[model samples]
Target: MNLHKILIFSSCLFLLPYLNIVLFIEETTSNFYEKYMSMLLVCNFIFSVLFWHNPISKSIIHKIDGFFAKLSVVTVFLYVAFIKDVDPYNENIFFLLYLFFISFARLSNKHSRKEWCSNSHIFYHFLMHLSGIFGGIVAFL
Candidate 1:
């Protein structure tokens, strides 16, 4: 990934845990799962930043980042769907939309690289951040 994209992606990852903590401070204190979930989110943010900045091959970095990103998403989905007793309909729909946006961003990124389209990659990077924001909103609501 480009350095700019990497920086923006890592920054977004860093914000996710903070956003959750701020938005659900009360629930985080009262709910055991939420507490642990917050910890996981923090760890995810830390490790993502570390891995992205580590001295590794770009391909390896991308693989590791992608794995952790997907894992974090799955963990959040499980927490929201099974652990919390919140309304499923809205949350599930939002989560699905988040997934859709992420998938499209990934696709766009791949196509941009293959076609040597820098603008497309930047657009997809923006979409990726937008998806993360939507996911944060879903968590809060």
Candidate 2:
């Protein structure tokens, strides 16, 4: 597909591990998800500022990313401001890597460096999910 589609599609792929983590964390406790949701907000804030003037990024993904990023920040604020306790490690770190992977993957595509990083991104993406299986075991046990 074209660049924009690739970015969005890649983003969707990048989101799978995150979604799984959300589900897995949900099973454990809402506080865990809230903590991670906070981290994602910080990540998104950095992403938006860094990519703000980037002409290469897809507008759709950029906008959606901004929305989610802001949502994450607000969610975390609300969680912390109201929630009694927040545990950082409840959600797997691999999920954070999942966000990094997707963002880098999209950025690489925007820069037309896909030939260099696409395969590696895909490889890491696959490995991250596989690691999630292991993480699930460790997390629940």
Candidate 3:
């Protein structure tokens, strides 16, 4: 992805977690978990912005971002797994799967051109948005 697309993608990824919190405030009755998750999401957003904006090699930035993104996913999964009142369901499973797919697509699209239909990177980003929304809905349940 170019810098423009990267910025947009980062913004969307940054916003979704907060949107999830706002949209599912009532469901997040567990204050500790909610706060912890929110903090992690915020940190992830900050990391994305900083890594993208820093004057470093694009390849290095991508590597760092990918690593942190995967770390965030694992952190989220562990958080949800250990937390109380979070019922494991198909949606949660799907969310994790979608996240994994997105990560894989991103890693595999290192040399992809920006073709909307054939570009797995763009498709992965689209799927990321959908999964974010789906995960938000699942958060309420």
Q: CA RMSD for every model?
A: 4.0, 9.1, 5.0
Query: What does the lDDT come to for candidate 3?
Result: 0.55
What's the distance in Å from true for residue 18, model 1? 3.0
By descending lDDT, how would the candidates be arranged?
1, 3, 2
Best by TM-score: 1
Each model's TM-score?
0.63, 0.31, 0.56
Error of 3 at 124 (Å): 2.6
- Candidate 2 per-residue lDDT, tens place, 1-141, comes to 222323333333434334545566565454475447535634553454344334244576466666765465345335433553424654435345445545654554454455532445444533433343333222332
lDDT of 1 at 6: 57
| Residue 140 C-alpha lDDT in model 3 | 33
TM-score of 3: 0.56
Tens digit of lDDT per residue, candidate 1, span 39-94? 65665566556654552435666676667666767766777766666687868776
Error of 3 at 79 (Å): 2.8
- Model 1 spans > 4 angstroms off: 1-10, 13-17, 22-24, 27-30, 47-60, 112-117
lDDT of 3 by residue, 59-119 (tens): 6665766676666566555655565456557546646865765665564455244443245
TM-score of 1: 0.63
Q: Local distance difference test, per candidate?
A: 0.61, 0.44, 0.55
Better of 1 and 2 by TM-score: 1
Tell me which residue pairs clash in candidate 1: none
